[model samples]
Target: MNTPEPLASTVVIKTVNLGRTLMDTEQQPLTILQGINLQINAGDSVAILGSSGAGKSTLLGLLAGLDQASTGEIYLNQQPLTQLNEEQRAQVRQKVGFVFQSFQLLGHLTALDNVMLPLELAGAKDYRKKAQNWLERVGLGHRIKHYPNQLSGGEQQRVAIARAFAGEPVVLFADEPTGNLDQKTGQTIIDLLFKLNRDQGTTLVLVTHDLELAQRCQQRYLLQDQQLILQTPAAVNPVNAEATP
Candidate 1:
């Protein structure tokens, strides 16, 4: 008989009835997300598709421990986020990586230094070599010395990706990673992202308006009306169902 893996080992992130809300000056409650539940297995690629202001990024932020939810539970690698303090959550976040729509690269740092930042922060030795290797893998070896403004949008995104991967996080969350690029460039970035995700076996949870990109993931989620729903019929083209907002 084969031994089975622990639940924690198989599931990278899980949530139950997760929700977030805010209050206006009048203390009027504004609900953003409610009854949001999700599960992402190790090495799985999942995408959450929604129009603008549908709370996709908000949900991602909550799951990533970047923002606290108003209610419900979130488990990251079997650790309960609701129970962890802000400082503790920050520690947890160190084990995860993120790629944002803006690329989020520091303008003053060269591509190499940008990639090296996380590794250095983690006190990892030989960060320079590791960062260089990741940059080369992303086809930016020759451009490692280039600053963010000196590089094209695609090149800058590649540098951001390299930085995200350098830390070897257990999971990666990406929000509108290709939103700023042209279609052709977006496709290239998508290919690179999925390839790296596959090669590294990193769990991927992405939020995007791009139907084609979302379809590439193993599972699909649609955020609507402050709720998260699984894509039905399994073969429906998301783009045909809703316009990218």
Candidate 2:
């Protein structure tokens, strides 16, 4: 599959000396991330790899404006997130989408409803049509009426992906998106993710422990010991090249 070239040099996400800390059981401050500085260009795919408990998800949450940092600042679409209060941060997140490992779907809502909920909340027009279109794009159209419990893990994830892209977000943050699936299922999900990234030009910031999945991205970083380390040069998609005939 062909990857889309970045639309411009626009920086969709940037971090400056970003750090996060939490109080431990005994009241000692435990630093999870520190001194992290990075810039993600529009239409780029970035992977953050780390062992479990290395704060990869924490960093993702901060970058997505779902959580505030203990120090430093995060800018999403040129808006400073660290300086914004919760409500203000939510306004900034209107342009953002998220996919999680646990599928994060409401048990009672059908797949279509799950995808439509956010759009409805945001007051988007023709939200039902948009939701249906996205579900079809993710190959879940036939399962639109199925609840999360009725679908397999991969199917549930496909619904989640549909929900994420339906909003037409500028950036998509995925946390261990394929963590619950078997290897084969995970590969299918990864392929779907890249295909959407290529087609829609959504900047992808993924957090995962899977190095193979990380290699599929344009840039890869390893989060370790409270720091982010660059693991590869940007704009290199070895997996895509190898997939070419």
Query: Considering every candidate listed, which one attains the maximal TM-score?
Result: 1
For residues 19-117, write the lDDT of model 2, one tens digit per residue. 999999999999999999999999999998766788988999999998989998788987878777889988999999999999999999999999999
Predictions in order: lDDT: 0.89, 0.89
Colliding pairs, model 1: none
lDDT of 2 at 142: 94
CA RMSD for every model?
4.0, 7.0
Clashes of each: 0, 0
lDDT of 1 by residue, 70-147 (tens): 998898876788888999998899889999999999999999999998899899899999999999999999999999
Pairs with backbone N, CA or C atoms under 3 Å apart (clashes), candidate 2: none
* C-alpha lDDT (0 to 100) for residue 179 of candidate 1: 97
Candidate 2 wrongly placed segments (more than 4 Å): 1-9, 233-245
Off-target runs (Cα >4 Å) in candidate 1 are 1-6, 233-235, 238-241
TM-score of model 2 (CA atoms): 0.91
Q: What is the lDDT of residue 129 in candidate 2?
A: 96
Model 2 worst lDDT run, 10 consecutive residues: 236-245
